[model samples]
Target: MATFRAELVIRNASVFYAHRFTRVNLAIRSGKIIGVWEPTVAGPEAEEIFDASGLYCFPGFIDPHVHFGLQLGSENCSDDCATGSTSAVFGGITSVFNFTPVLTGAEDELAALYKEVSQSTERYRTNLFMHLTVAEPKISPKKLVELALRYKFRSIKVFTTYSSSGRMTSDGYLMDLFKATRGTPLVVMVHAENDAMIDFREKKLSSDGPVKASHLPYLRPTISEVEAALRVCLMVSEMGGRLYLAHISSGKTVTELYRHFSALLGKSIFIETCPHYLYFSDAFLKGERAARFTTCPPLRPEEERQELLKHFYAGRIHTIGSDHCPFASWVKEKYEDDYLHMPNGLAGVELGFVLLYNLLKSRENEISVEELARMFSSNVSTAFGMFPQKGSLLPGADADITLFDPNAEWKVTLDTLHGRNDYDPYEGLKMKGKVDSTIIGGKFVVRNKQWVSTRVS
Candidate 1:
């Protein structure tokens, strides 16, 4: 496998740039993109070859935030590396940053989980990376950095919302964490919704009787997100720690990022938003649809959605994440009246690229597919310090590439999709452009717009 050469080659493809899509031919050698050269430079001794038939060549997308540690015992979420990577490949993603927290109740079990991953590297399809949420017991930020400087996790997650002792860390503790991890090149991903504010709002909502649709946005007000964002940004700024505001849904929070942004070496602030925030607003959840659209950092009004898109167009937002939590939609059926009880998070991993693809094309001939690549693949890799090697088509880079057909048409249906979650928020939505094929480390894991998941030496 180490000496493999050009197992598959696609010529005449529209190469995707961070902001536009263009034409190019990609050559592979031993699972690395040896060159992006002309067809005349293509070597005939390659194991296999194909004329892309005019498809879009994209560096495989990276989903910067995902939770694979979620467990339901025997009914555990069906997205382990095998299925998770299969789904990612379907969306043209060759790398994933799976988020794991020190398990809430079982502090001693952290080592076991770590061992499981360490022992099962080949069981996964794509090149998987991870971020461990630092726990006070085993992973205080300082110790976490030692683990990182030794073991090297790409990032660490911190929760500011949940009140449970194991979930959310105190602000002072968080500040110490930033200071401790400073200069380690560890990326701190924050779930920035103020716990105290949410507690106050929850009490108020409980006193207000049956939670109605009107209380959806009221319960988790924008103030909670804004205040948390401000505080976290201030902490990072003061201590000079690299921070990525994870799953930023509010336009108000994202709008202030630049004003709040300061870098020790221009590597301090990164702002990421989810598709749910960009596509569906609070308005989409009114009436019976409320349960369907539930997600943390509650979705805002349609106007805010428009504003968020504007932020992307203006380059204020750095990356887009699915934040693809997959609690069954029926688990939310009880929230028919009380929006407070409705489950948070909607599934969109499978639709991450499609939705963004649609948004890029709709901008009145403005943003091109190349820029889309930058925002999605290139920018995320750059933000997390994994670029050039994992996020480009340049020579010696991992041959992680996705080919999309800009004119490719596909209808997303529950039957054709694969996720442990039974429902899709983007269900019934027809989308344009899709991954025609996906290559992971020079392996054709997906071909002709379908997943060909298998063991690759």
Candidate 2:
């Protein structure tokens, strides 16, 4: 018998696998996990060893929805590939899935958009995947399938609102998209909000007086999301298509999902909620600095927020994406009074894992570390068709992993985070769990809470 030698070994850690945590030693070679064995079972010899005692090793976190280098009109998002991905790695994210440029009614724009996105990959510190955005109904189903196969992307994003911005897709087109991608690896990702309902509400609200940030809830009410979600569910059910609903802010929508289509969940349909929705309420949009909390499908009321949390604890929600699109403070400040035109997003990629971990730790009996790994890593990878390879600790998987300190305590501050943005939405909050190190492809990108990767200069 020959001795097995590994390039790297992580020893004496509580490694999450098969929905449970167990003490194990992981051996890696050439950026792949080759062995996960009991410490008592004579582990392979390694050239280098990492003492992971007292740490919990999880599959590296994945932020399934992020907007890096996103542009809206003349202004651009503050974080680009290098800076945004650096922030992600610091947050324990080893892979990110972002969106491609909006595909309007033109076929010619596809090639150029592909080139632009492909060229931007060199700046990414984390593994990057993209979802094609279909803005208009002019794109054919054949074209979408062809693009999905050619690019190896597994999802397409479409908006049901933002009609004024020309990003809204008609119900007819959505149905066609669903029917087209049925029985395929592609999942239809929808920004579920009724455009006509929003427009009507906005018009009605404006008739009363000038709309401020506080009026955000009134402008884009929960009913809009609930209605649109039901519509999407019906369409997917009829057409037998897979779906991923993005940034669900309303608990009422979750209730409606279970009431009507509970069986579809974790099967044909998946739901995603953001940290902001779980933490902040519509009350945050009332006073000065409210613009900072402004995001699409605006934060819900306290009751709804609490309800959403209850469902998450009940295991209804599938994943948590940062929805991390941040503008400089100046950009948000400029729209302080004119929130109707304000950009809709928040920055939390760096805080998402800690936020969820802290919440779960507070109610340790309700959720386990294994479930957290599923929401932050495995479930997302499964939904997006990257499982086993990108989201598991099993042999033959990528050696991407996150080491977390379950007892570490820290407060959110500008000094504790990294990004190009000038402000953090989660600033001033205390966090219990902290990411001690992040490994991608068997290499340390973040060690001892510090980034050491030169890949994203």
Indicate which candidate wins on TM-score.
2
TM-score of 1: 0.90
Clash count, one per candidate: 11, 0
Q: TM-score of each candidate?
A: 0.90, 0.97
Per-candidate local distance difference test: 0.73, 0.88
lDDT of 2 by residue, 40-151 (tens): 7887889999998889999999999999888876668989888899999988999999999788855567777788888888899998889888876466876776776677
lDDT of candidate 1 over 1-457, digit per residue (tens): 2233566667877776434555666768678887565555544346678678768788888988765535532224436666666677788878878866454433356566577667766766777787876555444667656666666677878888777345886788788878987777678888898888878878888886887655768877887888998889889878767888888887877766655563432358788898889888888767665676777778898877887888776657778887776666666665667665455666777778888889877883766556667766888888788888877877778888888877877777888677777778888877888778888888888889666668545
Question: Measured by C-alpha RMSD in angstroms, how accurate is candidate 2?
Answer: 1.5
lDDT of 1 at 17: 41
lDDT of 2 at 233: 96
Model 2 CA deviation exceeding 4 Å by range: 207-209
